[model samples]
Target: MSSAGPSPVRGGWLDPRKPFKDGVRPRKRQLGLALRDLCRLLHSDEPAETGRRPLKQAEAAKRLGCTADELSRYLNDTRIPSQDFLERLHKEAGTDAATSGQDVGITLEALLSLHTSALAERQGCEHCQEMSGRIDSLIQQVNAPCPQCAAHERRQEVRRRQLRRRQQRKLAIRLRSASKEQQTRLRLELAEVKVTVADLKAELAGKLATEAGLRERPAAAQPAGAQLPVPRRPGDRQLSARDVSAARQLVAQAEELDGSGREDLAFTLLQRSTAELLTPAETALVVVQLRCRERDRLADDLIHVYGRDQEKQDVMAVALELHEAGAPNDAGAVLRAALG
Candidate 1:
């Protein structure tokens, strides 16, 4: 007690040598430094236990559900980490530091902003880079063209194409071993997917051309004998018995998928079912079946498609009647249905 031992290191975690010791900025390199510092601090602060050895890098990586090599890349700014990994790190560090009476001085908001900037910058698209790290104006003209928006749309189209190809391959494999009834359903689904692919390809090509300043001139006026396309409301178009039956079967499949916790596929099936004309009764049945978060958007689309007042009223009335009759035969089914 008489002789004073060397003073313990104070605030060593905030060493000036660290890259983000001053502050965390919304940049890839800065984020990497911050993450590195955070990992080091957390690892150092972990208490030693009896008969237990801790390898700092491995333990830290294990806590964040990633490998040591991945962590090293993240720390070196050689690779960008996903949003989920960043979130996990923030949560773990916050919880651990709080218990140890230490402040890591990092925030999730800063990390996410950095991530967004990093992604936009990584794309190397001029418009995307220009739009990065700026708050976009909320007021956009209805028909105004945005190069950045077009870039994002094109990226989405690419992703959709990849997904469509993957689904097509899966369907092709299933068709070989599927029963006749299953084959019929699979073929119908495949045909629908093909039509969608064609539309997507056409739209993507138009977007690419527009971006490349290759817009085509308007076509010459059509002949007088050519009939203009007639616009019809949702309920105005008639669906055959075969179409109606197929829609019902899709609805049943969607319900089964939903029960099995496959909500994404279920919602897609629901969208496919509603893409065509449905009678008020069938629409009501779909309303009773839809339980996903996208139900509101689907309902709005339905209202837009079934635009006439009479048709809208009929859709609502049928939905209500089904609710009253316990159509799905489940307790509180209506309460959980899209209409309710």
Candidate 2:
């Protein structure tokens, strides 16, 4: 007893009977409850139909143009009927009542409304509660510092720095072992890559300035139903002659880098050139040209072959490859050439 164990914590938690502040009801529960009420009303015995036979499940299903199992599922709340089904059901119920000379006092519209209300009620209480819990967790996380997380992040940063240092060391060793000619070629490629990167930065700055200018312009009023012209991004603009020339020069430099076995640097330069120098359509055309060149190379591999059947098979395979590469028209042309 000795001080009653610090007067046992009382009434700290929320009361279960207390209503939620938002007053939002779970849709599924509401729909289920509504369906239960409807089922009861439909299945209830009528005093006016005392001498008449009750509607059997099979008969009801037949009238509704559904299987007996489907009707049973609907009555058991295992399945909800579609609007069309509900409408048909209402008509059938009315017809049965009329034939039996009983007033059921329910309309198709009323049944449809009940169904719609049930569906509308289907927003989940659990989902809202989960969202609220997540928000509270986020707020708590934002307000507090987690020591374990901080330590983990520190360890990760240390590991990353160590890995980067190791990579740099390995690259330095490789460069030291490379031939003089290879080193000179690599240095030149590096300079070219730097130049291309600088060009890309300048182009990006110019595009941003253009976008800012457009944004500052006053909005013009137009007639109703008239659409404004869609603004084009810098990348979408046609490549100028200067751009094409620069792209060609970059491509030539990249080829030299590649031939010198500095493919990584070559790829970097190519990417920069593509971004800063080529229009979308021009890039696509370049891709098609490269693909065609590759196809021709593969075709040349089979040129020395003597078998017509083998050549036809190889050509058909190439056509299929072209078709898969988004050049169905080119694929057809290849097939036609093979036939010729």
Clashes of each: 0, 2
Query: lDDT tens digits, residues 1-340, model 2?
Result: 1221112222311112223224334433333333322222232245876564544556556756888777655543335668887766656555655564554454556556556554544443455556545755897889797899989999999999999999999998887877566657656765765676467557756876776676566556445565544434433434445455554555566555656666665555554444444443333333344444453332222222211223465445545544655877655765665665
Q: In TM-score terms, which candidate is top?
A: 1
Stretches of candidate 2 off by over 4 Å are 1-178, 219-237, 240-243, 255-340
Collision pairs in model 1: none
Query: How many clashes in candidate 2?
Result: 2
C-alpha RMSD (angstroms) for model 2: 30.0
- Stretches of candidate 1 off by over 4 Å are 1-26, 44-55, 125-128, 131-340
lDDT of 1 by residue, 217-270 (tens): 333454546544432233442433543455455566655655666555555555
**RMSD in order of candidates:** 29.6, 30.0
How far off is residue 319 in model 1, in Å? Answer: 99
